[model samples]
Target: MMNLAVFASGNGSNFEAVMEAVKSGAVQGEVKLLVCDKEQAFAIERAKNHGIPTFVASPKKYSSKEAYETNVLKQLHENNVELIVLAGYMRLIGSTLLHAFEHRILNIHPSLLPAFPGLDAIGQAFDAKVKVSGVTVHYVDAGMDTGPIIAQESIYIEDGDTREDVQRKIQQVEHQLYPATIQKVIEQITRGV
Candidate 1:
């Protein structure tokens, strides 16, 4: 089975969804580690609840972001992580992390992209007056959310919908889409697809 290391920087709703998928055999993989940049992120609790190993490699602790990420990579390597999943991980992954894992890193973003690529994606979509916006699962690259697309789901935004409303819909899509894409990635790895 593919051994996954999940990265998160916040409340970990997406991380929890992935854990549920794994527990139900929907993901067809094993979660080997849960890594977070924040010391008190709720993701660590989620990992502990599911009996997954957890680690915190804060960037502020290291002299450089690259050094902090190197520490994370070292822990992942020690845990035998084969896939890295970014579920609400706020930090921008750099060249070293990308080189260490290559195309094995995957991220779920809150936009159809390359429509609205960065923070407050739902708000951006709302301000852009786009009728449709949703979720994207893509390969991680050096650029910010500019990696090759793997999958995307678009939700139609109704008239006068608030950013919160749009975000809620997008989050629903994210919960389903991330797990589905991760399953596909696992299949590709297992079958050499």
Candidate 2:
């Protein structure tokens, strides 16, 4: 099985979703590690509950972004992680990790992308009053969500839908699409496509 790592920053709902997918054999790899930037992030507890290894790399502890990412890189290398998945990982990936895992990282964003590229994407879509907004799974490039899209699934925003409603819908889609997309990516990589 391929070794995988998940980077998460908050409540870890998506992290949990991915773990569930792995458990159910919907995804064809093992989540070797859980990396979190926040010490107190609930994702750590989630990882622990599921018997997964956890690593915390707080930026404050390192002298530079590269330093922080270097530590993370060491852990990933030690675990032989082949694929890195970003699940609400708030920090922008720096060159240290980016160069180390070029085109091997994936991120699931809460918007169709090329549209609300940064934080609070669901809020951005809601504020724009768009009739349709969705989730995107893409390769993690140097730019902010500017990577080549791997897959996108759109959700219709009702006229009266609140931001919370849209967020909920987007998250539901994320939980499903992210794992399926990851599976497809793994297939492509294994096939050398």
Q: Give the number of the best model, judged by TM-score.
A: 2
Minimum summed lDDT over a 10-residue window in model 1 is located at 57-66
- Choose the strongest candidate by lDDT: 2
- Considering only N, C-alpha and C atoms within 3 Å, which residue pairs clash in candidate 2? none
lDDT of 1: 0.92
Can you write out model 1's per-residue Cα lDDT over 1-193, one digit (the tens) per residue? 7999999999999999999999899998899999998988999998999999998877888998888888888999999999999999998998778999988999999988898888878888899899988899999999999999999999999998888889889889999999999999999988886
Residue 6 in candidate 1, Cα distance off native in Å = 0.5
Model 2, CA-based lDDT: 0.94
C-alpha displacement of 191 in model 1, angstroms?
1.8
Please provide, for model 2 over 1-193, each residue's C-alpha lDDT reduced to its tens digit, 9 standing for 90 to 100: 6799999999999999999999999999999999999999999999999999999878988899998999999999999999999999998999999999998999999999899999999989998999999999999988999988999999999989989899999999999999999999899899988
User: Residue 68 in candidate 1 has what lDDT?
Assistant: 84
Can you give the lDDT of residue 144 in candidate 2? 95
Please give the CA lDDT of all the candidate structures.
0.92, 0.94
